[model samples]
Target: MSVPQAKSPPKAFDADSAQRALRLARETLQIEANALIALDQRLADGDHSIVQAVQLLLNCHGRVVVSGIGKSGHIARKIAATLASTGTPALFVHPAEAAHGDLGMITAHDVFIAISNSGEASELMSIGPIIKRMGAKLIAMTGNADSSLGELADVHLNTRVDKEACPLNLAPTASTTAALAMGDALAVAVLDARGFREEDFARSHPGGALGRRLLTHVRDVMRSGADIPAVSADTSLSAALEEITKKGMAMTAIVDVDGRVLGVFTDGDLRRLIEHVQDFTKLSIADVMHANPRTIEPQRLAVDAVAMMEEFRINQLLVADADGILVGALHIHDLTRAKVI
Candidate 1:
């Protein structure tokens, strides 16, 4: 038997190789960025297709049906999700599966957004006729405007790119980026047309921090009832200090006989008093308190409370009812712990 040749050793990693690798990666990013710039210029040059597609989606009475194959399918799913979260009802359906049985998901009042780089995906092409036959509007996102799927579409969005970021120019790099950008553009336009607000977005994302900040009311996250730190305005300074320590709040509310808040005494005020007064025992809580303190209503949003605290540079806020009676209290730490900050 002939002797096998010795296998060569693996090349050692060095600074030169690392530099070349980094340069290539940077070049790839720059090329993709340039593609986006070109797409932006094209849009600024008055590409009416994007606007027309947004109008079609806005006019859709039923849900939006987004369909694609392969990498385009992944991008299509993302587009569908974004549209759904931003107030537009949308879902992704695989074109191949649509041909199998998912076509039933499409309705006459729905709008179809089909994505394919070449505008010639056989799976999408197969469902194109069915979508049209069902009286659904078809919007095609493709690089080739003259391709079959483009010809069948009511609106053709041009997502063409001069080159792929891939060195071999075989992968869907720049094309997919352009397609995703176009989808985002359409979603934002429709969102603006429908006047979708942040509160509307928060409703769909109720489990998120933003939702908590927008939806949670001051009454929901406040220390109320016995937890409120308060003392009689005539209470001695020593007794007011005991109330603050017992209630575990840095401040205490001074209330009158009818339980209406007269003033507030805080740690900062205590510090200032110590600096100015020689005998703390002789002072009444009312004498050292800050009158007309900033207060928040129980019905306001927690985020508004945070804004108030930030604007007034106070760490705690007194929650009062319409009658100016102290109902609850909260600190910055409470908002931070609740993820409202």
Candidate 2:
């Protein structure tokens, strides 16, 4: 039997090959970035195609039905998601699926966004007549303005790219980037036109950190009732320290008999007092407290409280009611724990 030689494991690795690979990747990225810049210039030159597309979707009483094939289909799916998340109701309907039975999803009141790089995708072209017959308005996003799908559209958005980033010019690279950028532009314009606020976005995304920042009120995360570290102005320094220690907060609030906040005594004050006063135990909390400390209302958003804390260079704030009565308290750690920061 001839001795079989294991073909020397194909050059396990090559430093030169790795460097070439990185260079190619960087070049491709630069090309795609340049394509986006070109698209931006086209839009800035008074191209009303993007604005028209937004108006079409805005005026539609029904959902935005996005359809495309192949790579364009992938871009259509992403655009649909962006539109839906940002307040416009949208969903993707694959062109091939529409040819079968998904066409039932389209209605006269709906607005159709058909994406095709060449404006000649067979599946999209096949549905063009049926979409028109249904009386739905068709908006075409394509590189070829005179192609079949473009001719069939009520409005056309030209997503033409000067060149593809692919070395062979056969892959969808720059064109796809331009389409994505156009989709983003459409979504943002509609978002602004509809007056979509951060709170509205938070309502749609209640499980995310942004939702917590926009939706959580100061009272929701503040320590209230007995958990608040509070002491009377006449309270001895030792007793105030006990209140802070028992409450597990680094500070204590000095309040009047009516529960109105007079000032705050914090760990920083304790440190300063230790450095200056030889008999801290004999002093009252009023002597060591900082008067008119930063405060927020219970109804204020937690994110606003975080801003106040940052602006005032403090870690905690007292939550006061309309009458300036201390109802609760919050620390920077509270916002951190709530993921509002």
Q: Which one wins on lDDT?
A: 1
Q: What lDDT is reached at residue 272 by model 1? A: 83
* lDDT tens per residue, model 2, 1-341: 99998787676458998998899899889988998888788879987888888889889999999988889999999999999989999999999999999999999999999999999999999999899999999999999889998899999998988889888988999899889888888899999999999988988899998888889999899999999999999999999999999998899999999999999999988888888889876789998899987789999999899999888899988999989899999989999999998
Cα-lDDT of candidate 2: 0.91
RMSD of 2: 3.7
State how far residue 168 of model 2 sits from its true place (Å).
2.1
lDDT of 1 by residue, 84-169 (tens): 99999999999988899999999999999999999999999999998999999999999999999999999999999999988899
Stretches of candidate 2 off by over 4 Å are 1-23, 41-47
Q: What are the clash counts of all predictions, listed in order?
A: 0, 0
TM-score of each: 0.93, 0.89
lDDT of each: 0.92, 0.91
